[model samples]
Target chain A: MRHSTFFWFFLPTGLAMLLFIAFPIVSVISQSVFTPHEAVFVESENCGPFGCTTETTIDQDATAALREAKPLGQFVGLQIYLDRGHLATSEVAAAWRSTDSMGAFFKTINNLPFYRAMGFTLTYTFTVTPLLIILGFAIAVAVNSLHRHLKGLVIFFSLLPMIVTPLIGSLILFWMVDSRGVLGNFLQWMADDPDLSLKASTGLTWIMLIVYGVWHSAPFAFVVFYAGLQTLPQDTLESSRIDGATRWQQIRYVVIPHIMPLVTFVALIQIMDNFRVLEPIIGFNAEAHARSLSWIILNDLNGETQLLSSAATTSVLTILGVSILLSPVLVRTWRDFNSKA
Target chain B: MASQLNKKPLALSLFSTGFIVIWLILAAFPFIWTLWGSFKVELDFFSKADWTNALTGARTTVEYGSPFTGAGYHGAWVQEEFWRSVINTAIVCFFTVTISLTLGTLGGYALSRSGFKYVFWLLIAALIFRAMPPITLVSGYLLQFFNWNVWGILPTTIIVLVAINQPFTLWMLHSFFQKIPKELDESAIVDGCTRFQAFRYVIIPVMWPGVITTGLFSFLLAYNDFAVTTLLLAEENRTMVPAIAAFMGTTQTEGNVMFAVAAVVSATAPLFVLVMFFQRQIVSGLTAGAVKG
Candidate 1:
């Protein structure tokens, strides 16, 4: 009876998810494999002296000619799969030549720029996640340690970045970092060099991106960690202090352990958010650098062929990478919830 | 007694005060710069030599003609573009918040109490949609709507914006709804109220804080959003962020005073009002729904 009731309750959500999310993903995967090249010519009789007809024909004539043409081939099954998905190197190479002019599937792995993008995205996620976590933890602890009256003020200030639009955040950074802008002017003054620009190179751009990310993201982390701190048992800390543990020692041994679950949870959240870091990086720089996965995906979609299949493949990879990276956190959360139950 | 009371931990107080001051500065510096920059006209902002040239003269004409001519700060209040952006942002935010709150609250309540076995997966789906880069969805929707010819029922830009923001509002409201106790629903049902009636009379009133927080965040998110709005919204319908971006992009020739002032005013105004009004709820909502819970 309970199972039936639960099923009834979940049915609408289940159907909606299947239709919108699951279907689109599956469609992308399937479309990546099934679609054939336009090389499968429809008309045999239109194969004129040189080859296929270069002239336009009536629909009736085209239909008749197509019927006269021998059926190009059968559904080659996994060969189509291999060719379309670009899984087989030789097939990929062959398909590349045919598709290059028409702007179709990737001809060569070198043509895709996937590897460089992946490296950049991984570096961005790994770098930003830890910085956000540590900075957030520090800010949270600092706020938590304040006299009760002052805690509100600190939290209110911290919430500013999170509440402001990321576009504005990036714009503010852009203005500050521009050649004639505030930071740039200060740098020029200090160095006595007028030509030094923040966006001079990929490395400098990545650094700027990281600084912007930390500024924008730290508030979120702080809020989460602060809340986690609030939930920590006061008795544990009081007892640790009574046992002659210093404040730092108490935080390290007791408070930190108590908040580990929350930390892990927030870390996973940060990883997901950071992996899709787009606005600040985009607002700051136009080109895709070794910065974010989403930026690479956007760049690919904007390319000549509009190679949505490749974009879809990259999206799937990102989703998988995030899931895999966060598996341990997920497992731990599950275990904790189950144990409590 | 007063002296004894005043003898609280001096080191802790000093440390905290220093920390607060540093954080306040860090948080306030960019805003302060933006505010100051907004007041100065274009020439003063872009001039290589004198950063304070705008403050010193009303319309200082320098001999740097060709590209750098006709640049100086003007009063921010008199700028027409600034007011246009503010009005456009207000309209966009107004619709985005109102629609998202109504739909999100309804959807959240349905999922929370509907006892559906698939509710977890539904929640996960919403999260995935929220987590996916907005560019992907916005690009897809843009292409889809560009080809659309459905008797002009909904404007293409509005549809795209609403779709992109829906997942976020849904996730937020879901979290809010999950936190509400289920017992209230059961008791209301036991009193012969229908499900919808119970939701209307019992669940919504209690979930007011969640709804308000979700609405405020959604409004801010919509107002500040640049990526989706930039791609999807037309120039005439451009929201504040994109308008500022356009201004920033064109600042080399047009100058920066107007853009800077506009950026500062637009970014800070709504945020200030919201933070001030809902300081307590905002703190609790962010920590509870986002971080801890």
Candidate 2:
């Protein structure tokens, strides 16, 4: 395409992304360094009817002027990042000094809001990624062997868990696992303990959330692997069969290798998806028990006060996390582009 | 190769069959259970008194004088005004998909056809943007929207979603356009059509499959979104997903748990029908990025 044509064609999207996506990111970075202004105060004396009385009064006009002068707030670079809600630099140091044992120190750090959410987010991402890969691979291989007519029906059903709204699906599972809900009731019966409740325990809530994550995402991996299976080389499979290799060996040697690239692709996307685990946290109403980094940002931004600075700090951290996760894919894409060049 | 294994070993066959059955049940049962339970009274569905009431619909039978009841749907749709959110979601999804598709197609086509090596960097930028969580951007938007006095409105939310959605749309459509022969554009241009004319007359007609696939995904993103919608939309202009979330914030005495249940099923039904109709496009759209990526 010529320069003029390309310019005209790409301008709209480029501008949209620049103004909305790119500029907001810049704004978030800046906002992280600044906070909202506080009301100004001064001492004054009023001696009209009563004895001279000294009092503190908010200088409303000055406060308004100050706000108008610097609406984004005072610059406080890295302070929000190091605060107890985030990196908790001083809090961790104090906790370390207070604790005589490593176990207590570790526990104290785990209780911090930012560290706690980051811990769960990391654990969920790593656990769900590999688990879904294996599960999706198994389902894809099993479905590939079915009668052609039945494949589509199975796929249609398989997609339901993933295609449903994340909150809605998690709620469906949440209620089922609620104490009064069906599965919860059945579990209580099976355990011989009527007091069993997933909501009351942190471990139980985390388990249910992870299970929901796997259930909701595995179909995506399955469909991708299923597509990859069609492109598998028949000649190699025939050769393996002629060599008297068992089905297990065939899949181990032939099938796995055939879909290795697809596995990487799926893993990349899953990491990106899993790193932003917010909806499930809300869906389960497990904010008391579990929170993610995305949840932290939402928590800060959500309420009547609109804690913009705190939310911006979390956003910066969350973006940093995404960048670290994305670095591997970045390297590969760069290498691929170079090779093509 | 497996078919040639003269007698399919009983253990292997049973294992595969069992796995398939278990997976199907695991995937389908939650929705089915919820759908069935949504139609019943709270006691019968949750069954605090007797677990069997859930299976038997005992309370639902006594209350509604039928095995199934539409009370949940009525409460959610009419009493709670969930219909407003549903309509808002429709408007948002329709506009997001259409506008994003328009901008994405033009941009993607340009990227694919252009010979500049910087196109690689442009796409790489888009890839990074695509990986960003929508919530991360919401903080910045909140302040900006407030300053502009446009926060908590449908149009502003819609435009933001379209912007957030643009990167993925461009990535998918770029790859989609790349697969088309560039000769089509060249031929059209040679025949006296302008570049835009060639894109309109030649490329678009050939690109419906990919466009539809991308559009379906855009619609899903707009529909499934919780973060931006919840934050950016006002209380009065909430969409379905966020509205459902808001239902939980109400006082527990309202007996609106059933309303959420009904909304869940109601929201899910359209997706069920969507998959029924567009399973092929969906399957293809999902894998389209993978093989190419």
Query: Share of real interface contacts recovered by each model?
Result: 0.31, 0.89
Candidate 1 CAPRI-style tier: acceptable
Task: List per-model TM-scores for chain B.
Answer: 0.80, 0.96
Model 1 residue B224 CA deviation (Å) reads 3.0
Residues A234-335 of candidate 2 have per-residue lDDT tens digits of 889888888988878999999999899999999999999999999999989999999999998998888778888899999999999999999988999999
What TM-score does candidate 1 reach? 0.78
Score candidate 2 by lDDT.
Answer: 0.92
What local distance difference test score does each model get? 0.64, 0.92
Runs of candidate 2 with Cα error greater than 4 angstroms are A47-52
Docking class of 2: high
